[model samples]
Target: MMLKDKMRQLGRRDFLRYSAAGAGALMAPGLVRPARAETAGLTMHTWSAAVDTVQSHLSAFTAETGIPVNYGNSPWAQYREGMVAKFVGGAPLDAMWVSDSWLPEWAEAGWIAPVDEFDSLMKYNAEAEDFCTQSMTYGGRQYGLTYYTDYMAFLYDEAKLKEAGFDAPPSSWDELVEQSRVMKEKGIAEYPMMLAMAQESWLIEFISTLVYSHGGRLVDDSGSAVMQDSKEGAVEALQWVVDAVDKHKIVSPACVETGELAGLKSFAAGNHAFAMVAKYRLRMLNDPAQSQIAGNVKQAMMPQGANGSHATVGWMRFHGMSTQAAQDKARAENTAKLIEWFGGKSDGAYTFQKLLFLDIGAGFGVKPLFEDPEIRAAYDSYGDVNMIQAQQALARKKDTITPWFGEWNDTNGSAWQSAILGNVDAAGAVKKSADLWNELKDSY
Candidate 1:
C-alpha cells in the first residue's frame, strides 16, 4: 500500500511501528556504531547550536550510558514547518527541537506527547522552572522540555557613552532620549539606536517589551486580545518608537530597511551607538574578527518605562517527541536522556554556553550556569556588568504566553507588525489584531 493509504489503515500502535521503522531506516548506517546499543536507535531534528553543543557531546553520553545519538540539523525557520508536516502526515520522528511559542498550537493540535511522564529522568533547575512558567506551560500542563532561554537588552558602545559624558547607562527612557540627543549633537555617532523594525519578528519583540514595560498585556486573563489599542500604555509605547524615528531622530534611517542581523552588524561595526538586541549578541560584539567595537561594548537593562518599570523579552527553545516513529517509547526515552544529560551539570553546561554564544536560543535556562564565576567573567569580557542583573531583568519581565494555536503568530504578530511599520494606525492595528485574537480565543 502507498504511504498515505497505509497511514489511513493503521491504528496508533501500528502507526508507532511504521514511524519507528522509517526512523530506523534513516539511521541504519549509524546504528552499526557500538555506542548506539542502549538507545535501540533514536533520531532528533535540531537547529545548528544543538549540533555544536549536544551532538558534539554525544560521545560522552555514550561513554556513560552506551546510547548513541542520531542527530540532524536544520535552520530555525524550517524546523517547525518540517515537524508539523511530519506529525500531520503520520510519519514517525522520535524527538525534535521546537520553540516554546509553538507549544499552544502543537499541543492543541495533539501533535506532541507530554514530557511529564519522564519527570523522574529530569532534574528541575530554577532556570528551567522560569522557562517552564513562561514558555512551556499551557492551561497548567507542561507539554515539552526547555533547554534554552533568551531576551533582548540595551547594548551600547562604552567609549561612545563616555565620550558623550555619560558615566553610567540610562536608567529611564527619558534619559535614553537625552543621551541620544547629546550623542547626536556631538557627532559621537551618526544614529543613536539600531532597531530592526523591518524584521517582523524583531519588531514584535521590540514592541512586546515596550508594551509590557508600560504595564500592558498582549492578551488579557480571558485570553482575548485587549492591550494594543484599548490600553493607553500600549499606544504610548508604539508612539515612543515613532517618536524615536521621527521626532528624536536618534534611530538610524537604515532601520526602515534593516533586517535583524544587519542591525546587530551595524551596532558591532560602531556605525551606531546603541542597539536593542538579544543578550547573546554581546559575544559577537567582543569577537575581534566580527566586531570593530570588540573592547568597547557594554550591556544594560532595557530602559524603564513611564511607570519606572523596565521589561525585557524572554525567548525560549524547546524539544518534543514526534508521534511518528516506530520505536516511539525508546526514542522518547533516549531523547529525554539526551536533554537531561546535556543540560544537567555532569556535562558541565557546555551545551548551555554554546547555545548562548551561537544565538541558538537563550542560555539562561540554566540559572546556576550564570552564577558560575568563570562563566560570569567570560561574559563580563563582553561587558556584561554583573551578569546577575541581566538575569534579574529577564526574571522580572512580563512574558505573555499566548496559546500556541498555529494561527496565533499570524493573527497577533502580524497585527503588531502592522502598527510598528506604520501600515496601520495604532487603534486600527490593535482593533484588527484583537478581533482575530478574540476569534481564536472563542474557538478555544
Candidate 2:
C-alpha cells in the first residue's frame, strides 16, 4: 500500500505521491560476514527503499558464496519500464523485483526466466509457494520468487468506536454507515471513514476491494474486465463508495484527492475513525514515531458487503530472473545463489520472519512464520488476538493484470470518481465502464 509506483492508467503523474511512505524506516542490515570483498556480480533491481535498505545483507550472501553484489534501484515510476527495456534488450539483471500484475505480460513475452530449477530454493512455506504459484505461473512456467506481500484490512480506533457506542467494529455496510453516523453525531470523529478515492493507484486498490466486497469482480475467469457487466454487484458496490463520500456526506470532500498517505496521516492524527488499509500500513499507524493513534489503533476485517466480501484485494511482489541472466550459466548460478540468500532462505530453524516481514511490513511470504508461536508471542501478538488474522485476510478476487487493465483502471477510476462527485450516476457510469472494457479487449 505504501509504494504504489503504479504502472497503469492515471499513470506517472500521481505515481510518486505515495511510493515512498515507509522509506528509510527499515532497520539497519545485520550481515556479519566481516568480509566485504567487492565483486561486480549480481545486480538486483527494486524501486522501494525497504529493499534498498537490505543491500548490506548481500555481504552475508557474499560471505556464504563469495559472490559480490550490486544493488540497483530506480524511481518507482520508471522501474517497470526500465526493467522491461532491459529484459527486451537483453541487458542482464540476475534478479529483480516484479509485481504480480507485471508477471503475466513479462512471462508471456519471454522476458523473465523460469525458476523451476530453483524450486527448492524458493520455498519458505506454503503461503510463499502459493503466492509464487498464483502469480509467477504465467504460461505453464514459474518465473519468480515472492518476497513481499501486501493485503488489506480495516484499522479503526478503539477509543473512537467506544465513544460512538460501539464496542466492536462494524461487520456490514449498513453497520459501518450507522457507525459513522453515531461517531459523527457523538463528535467522536467528524469523518469516521477515509478511503483512497483519488484517481491514482490508491483508487484501484480501494475500488477493487469495495467491488470485491460487494461480490463484484473486475475481471472474469477469462481475464476480461467484467465488473461493468455485473451490474447488480458492481453498481451497488460503487454506489456505496459514492454515498459514503457525497450523499451521506460522511467522509470529507477532500477524499477525492486523498491517497494512502493522506488517509494514513488523517487516521494517525485521530482525524478519522476508520481507514480501509493494507496490513503493511500498520508499520506507520502503530509507530510511535509516525502516529498519534499508535498503540490505540486496532484492526478488523473490512466492513462486509451485502453478499459479504471476504477477500482483501491484494498485490504480492516477487523477484524474477531476466531470461538474459538464464542464458549465461555462471551468471545464472550466481544469481540463484544470491536470490536464495537474499530472497528469504531460512537457516534451517529461526527464519528471519521479523527481520524480513515485520520490520518493513513486507517480507517472507511464509504463512507458518506469521502463525509461528514465537513470532506471534514476540511481535504480532496484540494481547489475546494476533495480527496474522488481518494479514492472511489479503487475497485478490481477480487477476488484475490484463492487456486491458490500464484502460480498465483509467475508465473505471474516472467513472467511479465522477459518480462519487455527483457528475454521473453509479448505474450509468458502471454500465458505460463495462462496455468500454469490452471495447478495450477488442482494441487489444
Candidate 3:
C-alpha cells in the first residue's frame, strides 16, 4: 500500500496524532508564584512546543524572583505577525520569542527593548550567544536572547529510499529532482514532496534555504531585497518552486494549502519523503508514539547547489522584551530576570537544551553544553557535520534576511504561491514578488 494509503490504513492511528509528542506541556495553574502578591504577571509570546519547553524551566524563575509569567503562543508560521500585532495594539508583552530576521524591523520601529537594559541578567558565553544574535542587533543595542539554536538540514527515511531502489539520499538539487520523480513513479509517494506554501513567511524559510543551497544571495549587506531580478542563484531557486508544481509535479497539489505543521505531520505519517529539517524536529521524528517513521528517518546534510556549493540560515529564536516594559520598571526588571535566566549557563536553560536538543538529537547554540558528554552522545548521528555546516551557514545567513522579512514574504511569497497554484506564470510571479518586495523595502 502507498504511504498515503497507510494514513487511512484503518488499523493505524490517525495521521493528525502522529506528531502529538511535540505538543506543549499543560499550562498548569500556579506553576509559578510571585514572591510578592503585588508583583505583576508578565505576558510572553512564543510558539507551542517551545513554550512548553520554557514552561518546564520557568519554576526556577518564579520561585527565585516571584515573577509570574503567563504564556501566549501562536502557530510558528504566524508568530512574528502575532508579536507585531501585540506590539502595535500596545498589548502587554514582557518578553517573547522573535526570529533573527524579524528583529531589526521591530527594533527599528521601537517595538522591543534592549536586553542590555536589564540588571542582574545572566551572561551568555560568547560562542553560544552568537548563533542567532548577529541578525538581531541594531544601532549597537542588543535586543534579543537565544537559548536554543538550530539549522536547516534534510530529513528523510532511509527505508523509504530503499523501497524506491536508492541506497543514498540526494546530495544536489539535480539529484533531488530525479529521485523525487522515481519515488512518484514507484508509487512510494503520491506527492514527491510536502512543500510548505500556505503561510507566506513559512514558505520563505524553504525558499531561502534553496537560495542558499544554490549559492545565491537573497539580500545584500544593507538588508535590501535583491532576489527577484538578480542574476543570482535565487532565480533558479524560485523557478524550482514553480517547476516542482507545474512541470515535475514532484510536490503535493496541497502545497498551496499546507503549512509547517501539516507538512511535518504528513512526513511523520510516512506519506512524504523529504522535509526541511530544523533542530527541534528531531523530537517529532524519533518519538515512536508520535511517528510512524520513527527510527527510520534521519538527518542528512543539505543538498549542494548546481555549482557544488551551498548556503544556509542560522538558528536564533530569541526572547525579546517589549517596549511596554518601560511602563513599570519593577515588573520589567522581574521580566528581565526571567529572560536572564533563559540565557544563563544556569540549569533552567540548560535543562531546556537537554530536552529540546540533546535528548532529541538536535543541536543548540550554547557553548557550554557542547562540552557535556551526554549532550555530545545524543547528537552522535550528525557528528561534526553540524558544527562545520552551522558556522559556515551563520556567516552567510544575514544576507538572506532583513527586519522586513515578514512583510517581504507577504509581498513576494504570495506571488510564489500564485505561481505554484498556476494562477500566474513563473516570470510574472517573480516580477510581482520583486516589485512588491522593493516597495516594502523602501517603505520600511
lDDT tens string, model 2, 164-248? 7788888777788998988888888778888878887667778777877787777677766666654536788888878887776
- What is the Cα-based TM-score of model 1? 0.81
Top-scoring candidate (lDDT): 2
What are the per-model C-alpha RMSD values against the true structure? 8.9, 12.9, 13.5
**Tens-digit per-residue lDDT, 297-339, candidate 1:** 8777777777636666677676666544323666667767765
lDDT of 1 at 20: 97
Model 3, position 371: C-alpha lDDT score: 67
**Which portions of model 3 miss their true places by more than 4 Å?**
1-56, 65-93, 117-125, 129-131, 324-336, 347-349, 355-363, 377-403
- For all candidates in order, the CA lDDT equals 0.67, 0.70, 0.69
- The candidate 1 region of ten consecutive residues with least summed lDDT is 391-400
Model 1's alpha-carbon lDDT is 0.67
User: Per lDDT, what order, best first?
Assistant: 2, 3, 1
| Alpha carbon lDDT at 49, candidate 3 | 57
**Segments of candidate 2 deviating more than 4 angstroms:** 1-40, 51-53, 122-132, 349-353, 381-387, 390-394
